[model samples]
Target: MLPDALFSLTALLYVAATASFARYLAAPADGMDGAKVAEEGRRDVRLGTGLLAGAGVFHAAHILVFSLVLAVCPVEGIHFPLSVVAMLTVLFFVVLRGRFRIDAAGAVVAPFALSALLASRFVGMNAAPSTQVRSALLPFHVAFNLFGIALFSLACAAAGLYLVQERLLKRKQIFGLFKRLPPLDALDRAEHRFLLAGFPLLTLGILSGTAWAQKVEQGGLSDLLRAGFGWATWLTFAAVLLLRAAAGWRGRRAAWGTIAGFASSLVVLAIYLGRGGPGGHS
Candidate 1:
């Protein structure tokens, strides 16, 4: 009951945040006075940030209570992956939005978080791992992967915003959301830094997952597909970073690569959810 209540409140918070961000992005800047538009944008961003922060707090509580209610470890099954990932993503956005001046990116973050949160509620409720497949490394593998996915979510958001900002700049449409968004260079840097930070964690997750798979003798097609997409995600990010350092790939090229890598990671996640749960095939 407590978990349910917390979940409801969290959902409402996310909805409010999403609305605020949408308003900020969609509000006209041409007809309105420049000062009024700037003020309104700032107000909306602050409200959205605050609402998102509250949502994160409630999300954490919901996870804890939900895990307790089920008497299950949060990291042990697919039940919490989407929820945890969403929560971490929101928390990260709230924390770094100011630092990175990416508050405008909340337009993406809020809806994604809300959708993931709602999806987590309906997916994998009955799935659990058998005793034979359980291992000490399983929790670490899930944790690392979840955290990496959260960071990748942020990178994708920044990359998406960078693309929009770049398009507007190219076309010379600089009035509305363009004025509200962070600079193009900042978005690029944020995307690159997020990828760099998440890469090592993803590597650890892949290594731990491989060892766990070997231990469990998971040789099925689903396992193979998941591994393939997971590696594809890692390789894509690696190439993006490598090219950026070696061949001066930044801006649009790097943004597209990050989006592609994030899409691959989502495919891996979809495979997990499709199997009923992470533990279902373990």
Candidate 2:
């Protein structure tokens, strides 16, 4: 109950932050100043970011206390996958936003965090798999998968914005929201680095997952489907990285690849969370 209360409070903070960021992004371009107009709305962005940071603090505390009370590993349960995903995605964005100059991306991140937290509240909690969690390698697999998915989500957000900004550029319409997004090259580079950072973790997760599946005798339809998506996701991102290296694929092509890869990961996540799925969260 206490964890629920904390989670509710955190969700509210995320909602407020989402509203602030939306307004910040959609604000009128009045009072033209020679200084950077993005700076003009820094007040809203800063307020929103501060609130979201506070929310993240409470979110972490909620997970810690909740896990302790349930005697369950937060990362090992199907119930908390969405919550962890959203939390890591938003907090990671907060850390890297300035570095990447992708403040506008918060428009997507805040609502996503809020939605995930809400979903966690309403959904029934699934206990960790007995046989799966007993393995010594389980923690490593879950940790790497969680962190990898989080990074991939952030990368997809950047890539999505890149596509929008790229479209606006091609249309020669650079007056409104287009001005707010990060430069194309910056987004591309950020996506690339994020993929690079996450790919190794993904590799480790897949390898460990395969071993655990074998140990647990998990080869059902849901298990196989989840595995398929995991491998497909790995391959998709791998190609995205390789093509970028070998064929100079950096713009629209790369964004598509990132989005496709993330979409496949989402399928894997969905399968894990629903019906007769694989062991615990993937």
Candidate 3:
């Protein structure tokens, strides 16, 4: 219950920050003409960043509490996995903030929004069954999968934003929205880096999952179908990577591929959870 309260508060703060970031992006400073608007935008961005940072700190604290609770009690259901995903997603964006102008475009807020929505689903859902596994490799497998999803989810959000920004640019419809977005090239570059990071991690996750399944005699035809879906997601990304290399697939198509792949992966996760995973929480 404490964790839930902390999570909800963090979510509300994030929603507020998202709004502010949107405002900052919509209004950038021009020399003399838009000076006042730009100043206000800057203030909004600063405030938004501060709020996001606060939310992140509180979010980490909540997770720490959850970790302690799980250590003493049984870790239940989708909440833990979803919480881990949300926390890591925010962490990844925070790291990228140091290197990119992503803050200017409100990219940080979107992932939090996604996380919040996903987490909230547990409000009414049944708890996941806790299963004990005694293997050194299990932790690594879980870590890789969670972090991979975090990276890909960010890429998905950026791709969505890129598509919108690209379409607006192509149509010569520069307005408030245009002012708020980063240059298209930068978004493309960031998305590429995210994909590069995510694909390898995802491969590790798939390999680890297969190994775990095999150890438990779970590698039958059903496992094959699940693996196939996982591969399908990977192939989608591979195709996007290939097109990016040869045909220069830059914007919307790339984003769409990321979304598709992530969605498929989520479905696979749902299946695993529904079936009661061999040792991990089902």
Candidate maximizing TM-score: 1
RMSD (Å) per prediction: 1.3, 2.1, 3.6
Off by over 4 Å in 2: 30-36, 124-128, 131-133, 275-282
163, model 2: CA deviation in Å? Answer: 0.8
- The per-residue C-alpha lDDT of model 2 at residue 58 equals 89
Ranking under lDDT, best-scoring first?
Answer: 1, 2, 3
TM-score of each: 0.97, 0.93, 0.83
Candidate 2's residue-wise lDDT over 118-182, tens digit each?
88765546544555446777777878888999999989988998999999999997755676667
Instruction: Name the top lDDT candidate.
Output: 1
- lDDT of residue 250 for candidate 3: 68
Ranking by TM-score: 1, 2, 3
* Candidate 2: 10-residue stretch with minimal lDDT: 273-282
Q: For model 3, give the 10-residue run with minimal summed lDDT.
A: 70-79
Please give, for residues 183-202, the per-residue lDDT of candidate 1 as tens digits.
Answer: 89889989998899899999
Q: Which scores better on lDDT, 1 or 2?
A: 1
Give the lDDT of residue 41 in candidate 2: 74
